[model samples]
Target: MTKELLKSTLAELSLAENSTSIIGIKRGIERETLRINNQGRLSSLPHPKKIGSALTHKYITTDFAESLLEFITPATDSAERTLNQLRDIQKYTQARLDNEVLWPMSMPCFIKNQNEIALAQYGSSNVGQMKTLYREGLKNRYGSMMQAIAGVHFNISFPKSFWNRLQVIKGDKTDSQSFISNGYLGLIRNFKRDLWLISYLFGASPALCSSFLEGKESRLPFEKLGKGSLYLPFGTALRLGDLGYTNSAQSALKVTYNSLEEYIIGLKRAISTDSDLYRTIETHSDGSLKQLNSNILQIENEFYSPIRPKRNALAGETPIDALTRDGIEYVEVRALDVNPFSDTGISLQQVYFLDVFLLYCLLNDSPEMDNEEQKISQKNLEQVVNFGRDPSLELIKKGASIPLRKWGEETFEQLALIANWLDTAHGTTHYKTAISELNLCIEDSDKTLSGQYMSALKNSGLDNGCFALELAKQYQVKTQEHQYLELSESDLNNESAHSFVKQKEIENSDEVTFDEFLTAYFK
Candidate 1:
């Protein structure tokens, strides 16, 4: 493709005009405040729910967009090492600050640790250690690299003290407080954060490590990483708890490796050759992915949020968008968890696996399936969800009982082949092990983190929360054992080195309000 054509393709992939993707704020009744009303016998009633935040991340596309993810980019030449050294110092300073400064003035109980995790609740003896493990493991392994560039966190909260002073009489009360509860406010803040994180991580990650890192020269516009420097494609999100958020989950991946036309052909072959990958789904009289008169679009219109909603209330409904733009569209990777148990919410293995999987998706580049084929794919997805580990989930190509695991194995081999190709192209064997790990997951359940957590929960007689806490503790122990031996006494005593690093980070950070943060992010 020509430079101009590639740029336009990526821009179209981002669906720049899809304002329906924006999230909005709304006002409603505050359900949780009812108990407080009874306790105070308040004459003035408070509105139950208040909309507090809106979110959108800008799209980043360029004439050389296809070259973006072809290399890696970092704020510093060695991001991982620099971040680790800085975090080690911060951890030591933070420990002392907690006991000496913050504890005396702020609500110590409410303060989240450096890991951005809350302390353990009462009756839970393991929360403390869980928090400790998360901090230490992350510090020892990846350091604070991701957190630094991830941007500052602005907490959305209600001014409860102001609310308490409101007078009931029309003239007496100022009615200054917003209608939303602090919890909902927090939720909105989290939603905004999630969107931004997903966008940046999704679009930049592949480019940052692969293209920029490998490129001999800088690609950043004006050699600066300004807010609008490039088409910042993946830079927004909307949280939906464990189900995985997708508000900011749109990107136009450059078809540097394959064309949309070619991709469609690949999808057809994938299903046709592997009868196990397809299944029959009854269609409506119109005969498509669904019925025509009944109109899947009607069900979609009523039951789902717009591709992007103009306001927040619309977000309450489902926010799933399936349309693929002309060139680049973000692939929704929906199998992530906050791991309420782990401090960072995910593991290195999971991150590595995701990197490899996404590379496979991009390089192998499956074509879009037709309506009938799409229905079959949906059935395959449902089977993966409901009977994923089941050996016999009844997969059929041309109406034969094919085992699900067998199909899965065959699909993975195709993936592994792509991974091996990428490994050869990149001259990096790291991905081969990652691909092998998936095969291992297929063989031994214990190899995967999810399986390990399940085993821990089942054998330890603990709830999910408690089990996460214990595992965090165990992970911490392992991390300390591995990393502690690598450090020297001299490195520990280098306080000035730590200060210099912190100064650089502060200078780089955007000094802006929550509103400014949102505006700059989406713009």
Candidate 2:
């Protein structure tokens, strides 16, 4: 869709919808800290009791490693509210970490040793056991270092009013759920096409400690910061590049993004599909199951992608089950790095920019991603990740080579137009302000998060450890200085106490043995 078409569509809807566009935003911030003491080595302390159980906590949970904290916020239509909730979570969480500080960046810098990175433990319940088993399978396949990489997930969705208004405008009789799901699919296609730009501008994991490589060579030559720290001179996000998550089996799947049906089918098939090497993974070895099942994915969440379509699943409902029945309620953007400079690892401006970009994706015409286009997109993504800051960086657009700057300007031209529509709908110029900031980054790459990271490292002449830890301490102080309205420190403390009991209840409620559970699931 062109700027004219998007304006025309919004203009028609504004008359009936009263210029209201309800944009619900939910953010989950997962940070993997080294759990260091004053010495800056890895800490081996168990998860703090005051932080709540990783198994049952609604707000705080563990990701790949027990030390990897994932804080999720409830969905809110206001960016300020969502960010406040995130700030409170961080403030409350850091208060509980006895001696540890957040790692401050996407790439973890220091480790005493690899064995110290333990898979997150839930409990003895079947579900908890299954969660650990999935991580074990990941550790078995991808190594612990890859699983330890931390980032941010931004989930957003429009309300039913938007869909109904769109339907009324289109005069389409398709089922409301189908229409919404397909619209989200169109947005996904557009996102995949343009996400490289986001990675280039906002990507922050340009550097990593050599220990993370586990003796493997950097895919590209990396400049050394210190004895163990290495970074690509122009790397944007090494965490999302070739050195990141890679699965030979999934690479072969070639999941399609043409439509919702195709996307769901691909996911379901991948979950059921088996590989000979993975099949050898023993479900029961020492009276405990090894994984959910020996397939390409232990479950649907195992499929690593930069973005995913999501539906809020019911109890005992798989992600696929929820999406299959309820359609895509929202989409999660997983490519964002944890900005080292921000106290919250993200900023209001970044969030606002994302809102406009996502809306732009939805209002645009998204052609299906064919296999050849998929190849090109993947190539484009890798180039930007490794060499995005290079002056001669180019991206492929509609079979023609275009300078990244030129392509970015063309895309921003449309975004500027859409930003105005957003400002009109929200009754604020926040959307426009977001684009204006990014416009500066397009002109000078050094203004970008990635560029700033490199410059920061140079100014201090600090290794990843010294630099990130200093930033981490600075942000921790800033976070403590901030105030929360809806939630208090007392409220988080009470929630933590309740979650501990909930974990025990879940453990006591387990009736089926681990072996029995796996046998039944496989059948």
Candidate 3:
């Protein structure tokens, strides 16, 4: 029944009028990496001034920790161009680093303590202070070690023309924005249901430095490696597992994605409701702010999810407020680990596959997911993360157990159809090529990123940190040797100087005290 609906949708989309809509898909990336010194310890130095002020830089910024760099690309219609922009940003940043190199893996390098991870500073403006304070809240709630783990975020949106065509095909009469938002919600629901496939295929963090688990107790059976690392024999993305950036408290929130209004309401309730667990943590110490608030979430960004529906928020506008005002402008996929094998955090081939998979989500038949279904999806993802390469692993679909490989094969069969559609739209076979390459990973788990990474680690007989550091150094050299692809050195330098001026302008423009600013923001 579901397959028939998907086939019908595809037939409609393949019409000449709707074909251009597929080509109009827009995408951007936010790739995060931690800076480490020669010895593979997290850099304690402040964000590089030569790169630009973290508060005002358009392409480059810090995430959670001062040493963790986030490189963003402008939204473009071509995945190859987006990747080139990412590479240019990384190359520019690499040129500015005095001696630090970007860590190549999703899991962080050796860190003796949480104090070693410094909160990202954004200068003294009220807004900047609030940004830092939010991280402070995250630190108090989830610990800084988890924040140090880096990931690649893929932000994608269908063009307005595509939504219009889709709405017409479905014979929907809702307002344009309402129809578009509903379409994205359906896409999100399907993405959530099938995200485990992403974990299984692209997940790279099979092993991690043992230091990450310091002062924590875990129930997973992790095997020791070289006296300094721990790993699951068949783990895919440990970074997406419990030891990574997970919030146990939010599990009870049961946030649903059925509608824009309901999603916004749930998030607002989380931000406004006080948390008994967090209340005990001091909000201020020695007259300095320790965190933003003692709420279930300090802000909308604090709520963790593998994927999120997003709209670009205006100045002083919260994420939910932006969504409420304009609806979801894009969807952000945060399930991806930083690909250790790529010079950039992610590869173009991976982007191609994502394009097909997300389009599949949009075109596939997605029904409203109840709480039980949500739980099943979560369970499937967890199972894949922990034992994706294990042939015996099975997943639940509609209360029936199916072998993981069988389910993956079925998903690929549908995705290949979408890939062909995308190929025809773009007049190229890259999408189909991506589908064929990744299909092999589904058939043979040993071809997956986790399998390859684990095999390499075992062969090297080195700890996770040592192996990752070697790759980091190699990538740094390669990045430095390559000329800028989509941007020039002059362009980066001018942007850096302009960012400093912009930071000062923002600092000067502040009119209210910090407390007043917070009150106004919350209000």
Candidate 4:
């Protein structure tokens, strides 16, 4: 359907429902962990027990490293509830921390010594061991600096009611699971095509402490910021830019979102596809396992992309296996940079804008993306990540070039209508306000997050470490002082205790040896 038709359809549908559609928009946030001491150095601290076990806790877990704490929220329809839960996790964590502060920026600040940063360690259980082993493989494959760069993942899914209504609108007769899966794939295609917009608008890691770039190659025109920071005056998100180690191998995968089956086939092939380069890096000499396998992908999760299709994996199932078996339960938008300005690293406006944009992706025509177009999209994303604030910047479309502001403004014009439709549905102007706020960024480049961050950095003597350390402490205090919205202290404590028991149960239940488990899991 065209934009006009979609607008009318939304209007009609909004009136048909007793209230608004009140569609279920579930969110799950995963951010990598970092904690620092009073000296503003990366701390060598253990995961606090009061916060909950990283192994089995539903709310808190470790991602790439032990210091990289990943907070997971249950699928929540209310964005505030999701943020509240995330804040509670951070709140309790901050209070329990002796003197450590969570690192607020995506590109980490000053690490007193890079050698001191360690890969995550898990316990003796087979599952925990495998988790730690995966980190080891990541460290070996990509240097610790590459692995330390952190960002946020936003997982989104629509309710069955929304799908049923959409199917009725389109006269679709496929099974609900398959239909929803295809719908999400369509969303993914559009998101990839336009994802450069996200990096331009929301990407926040434009600078880093010079310490992070130690013994590494950087060609950008980086200016010295105070004693430690090095930043690109025009950089959007250095974390997402042409970082050498992160994108090298995955770029060759060429995974497409044309269809759910096609996407799965591509990933499955990658998992089985061996890499000559990887084979040269022997993980172990013993008969025991080395890095899952000498494949292009250690597992499906190894294939990095700005966005991904996901499902809650069944016990013993891999991410790809779960999505293939159950269809796409949600699309994980991995393009978000950690917003330093907010106490929670995300704002209600960001969340609401995401809702409107994803809905637009669903309603808009999402043609299958070919390899050439995919390459173009990748190029556009990289450019935006590094130099998006450039007024003369141009982006590719259908083998043609268009001015970035023209394209961005045109996109927002449509988003305004989407925002209105959302406003009518939700009985609030939150969506429209976010759209208006972003449109201003297009109108004036300096208003954009990256631009604003750069301006602020200059005012602070261009010190990323100065701002990061202070902001981390401020956010920690804000989180600690905020009243619990959904969770009581007692509830959080019980969760921690029960989660510890669950971890023990998991450890006790593992019957197979680590080697056997890895072999079986890889297969």
Candidate 5:
């Protein structure tokens, strides 16, 4: 029945008028990396001035630490154009670093202590101070080492015309916003159910320097590599596993994705509720704020998830408010590991595959997920991240165990159909080619990124840090030699100069004290 429904949906969407709508799919990327010294230690220097102010820059900004740089690309319909923009942004930034290089992996290089990680600074503006305080709270809750782990985020949204056609095909009479929001919610539910496949195919973080553990206890049976690294022989992406960016405190929230209202209500309750565990932590120290608040979550962004339904919030508006008012404008996939093989951290072929996968999520049959089903999904993701390449691995499906390879093969067969439709829509073979290449990874675990990365590490007889450092140096050299593709050097220089001016304007416009600002924000 599910297969028939998917087939019918695709058939309806294949009409000439509806097929053209697929060409309008928009996408954007946000890639994060840490700046390291020549020796691969985390850089202690402040954000580079030549890269623009992290507070106001539109394209370049700091995420958690001052050394953790985030590069963003504007939404575009062309995958090639998006990758070009990302490459140009990275190239421009790399040329400006005096003696620092961008780390090429999802895991951190080396850290002597927590003191080595500094919260990102955004000048003297009230909003800037609040940004730093939020990071301070994250450090208190999860530790700074976890914040150093970086990844790539892919944001995508179908055109309004496609949604309109989908609504017509489904014979729905609801309002436009209601239909679109519900459609995206269904997509989120399906994505959550099947995202373990993503981990098994594209996950790249198999090992890490022991320094990242920071003496913390873990249950994974990690083996020692060289003298300072630890790894799981068949691990795909340890960054998404138990010791990575997970929040144990959030387990009680029981957030559901059945509807936009339910999702918003859950998040609202979390931000408004105070936590007994966080209450003991000091909010103020030495006449300076240590954190934004002692709530379970300082803001909606603090709630971690593999994917998010997003709408660009206006000034002074919270993310949930924006969603409640205008509904979801796009969905951001946050589960991707930074691809070590690509200079841009994500390849164009990966983007092509993602387009097909997300469309499949949108068009497929998705039912409401109960708490039991949610638990199963989480467990499946955990299993894949830890032992994905193990031949004996199995995943739980509807209370029945299925071999990992069997499930993956079935998923890919469906994805192949969607890829063909996309190819016909664009009059090109790129989507088919991408699916064909990735399908091999499903057949043979050794073809996956994690497998290749581990093989390279073993062949060189170098630890994770040493191997990543070598790649970082090579990437820096290549970036310097390459010319800009989508953006020019002059364009980036102007953006940097304008960002400085914008930062100054914001600093001068602050009229109230930060305490008053925080009160108004929460109110």
Candidate 6:
């Protein structure tokens, strides 16, 4: 979570300075574990008992000199570094590809937990284990600086047809029953054909490729492209779209967390208070509904943020490019569910897989997409999403009838090539090991996180809650173990430096209100 997001959520929740933590309590027996004091108020997660003290008096004195000093000085070193890294990466990749920048699209997926642990907690608008995992990840990767990261938690509804299409892409079109997108109520209602024009954003731009390489090999950038520049095969499911987590449907990916002010600015851009994009479900009384709706909206907006508004010479271009120029890189990847049966939230194997995959995307100089191709890409995408695992899924790249498993294998091979290249360039065999593990996983499906999850759930009598909760518990354990080695004293110190800089700025900042800052900055 971003610092600005944390502050806003804390403020909105009326949390006091003494409040140690904010838990997301859901309905179910788990509620017993995560109950609230005073009035039995249900939270989004469970919280511990006796959380510090109540609120006390606080004040601030604002002046012009303070404001100028604040304006001129950055909130944190990480803020500058993160933004610079994003800019450098973007510039290098864009120059290498010699194409216009294209913003990544995040797609949302609504998964159904067939068996919830508790009745009250089952199916509530709460992220239980996921929240724990997110917080844990922050502590390990960014530690206290994690508090400065900004992001949001939002839900999305997609038709069952989405999965069905993936099945088709996997060549299971004959399963007439598989294409039905009518099971989940949320998807059936919210993901009607009219609202979402499902489309694929192809890996590369055909026009750019044609311009750059004059040969039969250049038939549309996505065609028969072995491993994409993103390093993964064209078929490897990358949580690139908005579903969040960079890959998950509701991840806090692309958050600017280096500073509180930048995080706030990013939040405002993500979900405007006045936008009609907000979706409201009528369940309680009209008055209650109104209040709940508004509150929930506020809750979401306060999470993910956007860059501070500014006059752009390139007004209607990709925000990714814009943000990159300003020294910020969006870390997209959230779709991955913690394999419930895995000892960890994910595996070292999976982690390595991602490393190679991401490096491939970064290093591979692919083309961008055109308006016409973008439309066709959507159709092609639907085919894969719904029928990805089928034996005869029709890929966008013509003349391919390979089974999904085979496709996965082929993609891994390409990924291995990239991993080898990375090893040569960076002298790090981490990518190579990741690739090798991925190949091994194909041979032993039981070792795959998803496979393990399904098998465990089945063995556990299809208990979804137990499965989920167990997944969460195991993840907690694994993360603690993995963390010890990844975060060294130096890394912790760097994070401390980042935090110290931000804290000092907060202490010295002038009284220029956030609104004022926005008006002046944008104008």
Alpha-carbon local distance difference test for all models: 0.27, 0.81, 0.90, 0.80, 0.91, 0.29
lDDT of 4 by residue, 291-403 (tens): 76778887777778888888888888888878878899888888788888877778788998898889888878788888778889889988888788889889997788999
TM-scores of all predicted structures: 0.35, 0.95, 0.98, 0.96, 0.99, 0.39
* Candidate 4 accuracy as lDDT: 0.80
- The predictions' CA RMSDs to the true structure, in order, are 25.1, 2.0, 1.1, 1.8, 1.0, 22.8
User: TM-score of the candidate numbered 1?
Assistant: 0.35
**Tens digit per residue, CA lDDT, model 3, 243-326:** 887887788787888999989888988998899999888745577667788888888898888999999999877788799999
Of 2 and 5, the candidate ahead on lDDT is 5
Model 4 superposed RMSD (Cα): 1.8
Compose the digit string of candidate 6's lDDT tens values, residues 1-523: 2223323332332323212221110100000011111221112221111111001001011101110000011112122232232222222222222111111111111112211111111111122222222333322222222121111111112223333433443355544332221112112121111011111111111101111121225222233221111111222222212211221212322333333334445454543343232243333354322222222123231342211221122532333335334422223232243222323223344444544554333223223323243334434443433333233554443233444456456556656765665455445577787678657654554444334433444466523332333433443344334422322434433443454454345435535643353334333
What is the descending lDDT order? 5, 3, 2, 4, 6, 1
Supply candidate 6's per-residue lDDT for 130: 22
Give stretches of model 6 more than 4 Å off.
1-331, 339-344, 362-365, 371-386, 398-406, 424-430, 440-447, 474-523
Q: Could you give candidate 1's per-residue lDDT for residues 279-359 as a string of tens digits?
A: 222443764222111211211222111111111223222222122122222222332323323322333344444444433
lDDT of 2: 0.81
Q: What lDDT would candidate 5 get against the real structure?
A: 0.91
> Residue 237 deviation, candidate 5, in Å?
0.9
Candidate closer to the true structure by TM-score (higher is better), 2 or 5: 5
